[model samples]
Target: MTPNAIAEHFDTTRQAVSKHLRILTECELVTQKQQGREIYYQLEIDKMKEIDKWLEQFRKIWETRFNQLDNLLATIKNKKNE
Candidate 1:
């Protein structure tokens, strides 16, 4: 979407949206195309997928840790009841 279009969904200024778009464009997360007077931005799906894949590892680790904590708490509760 164009910067103005994206800005319309948010309460921020058009310049803030443009600034964020610029950062994303620089990071290769979004690509920009100039069509006449407007610059349209599109997300790089492959780059996003790469990011998701990288974050998946941490997600799994955190889930396991949370489960372990739950088990530990259950054990403590059981011991208290005993």
Candidate 2:
């Protein structure tokens, strides 16, 4: 979609949408092509997959930490009841 369409959908200004689009384009997460006077932007699926993989690694780390916290909380509760 064009920046104007995205701006309208988000109820934001076209300039703001254009700035966000530029950032995404720099990250290679989104690509833009010129079609006559308008620029069309499309999502880069491979870049999205790479991001998903990176986030998944962090999710596992957080899950392990949460499990440890839960165990510590249980132990504290048991000690208080003793």
Candidate 3:
């Protein structure tokens, strides 16, 4: 999407959107192609998928810890009632 379009969707200024796109381009998460007077941006989906998979590992650990905390709290509540 053009920076103008992105800014409209994000409710931000086009200059702000362009700045973010520039950072993404530098990080290699987005690629920019020039066609005549237009600059088009494309996301690197494979990079996104890799990041998602990496974060999922931590998500699983957090889920397990939260489940254990819930169990512990329930046990304490039951003991207080006994």
TM-scores for all candidates: the values are: 0.79, 0.75, 0.74
Cα lDDT tens digits, model 3, 1-82, are 7777678898788899999999999988899988888888999999889889989999999999999999999999999999
Model 2, 1-82: lDDT tens per residue?
9998888889778999999999999999999999999999999999999999989989999999999999999999999999
Candidates' lDDT values, in order?
Answer: 0.98, 0.96, 0.91
Single out the weakest 10-residue window by summed lDDT for candidate 3: 1-10
Winning candidate number (TM-score)? 1
Once superposed on the true structure, which residue ranges of model 2 sit more than 4 Å away at CA? Answer: 65-82
Compared with the true structure, what per-residue lDDT tens digits does model 1 show for residues 1-82?
A: 9999999999999999999999999999999999999999999999999999999999999999999999999999999999
State which candidate, 2 or 3, has the greater TM-score.
Answer: 2
Off by over 4 Å in 1: 69-82
User: Which pairs in model 3 have colliding backbones?
Assistant: none
Clashing pairs in 1: none
- The total of clashing pairs for model 3 equals 0
Residue 13 alpha-carbon offset, candidate 2, angstroms = 1.3
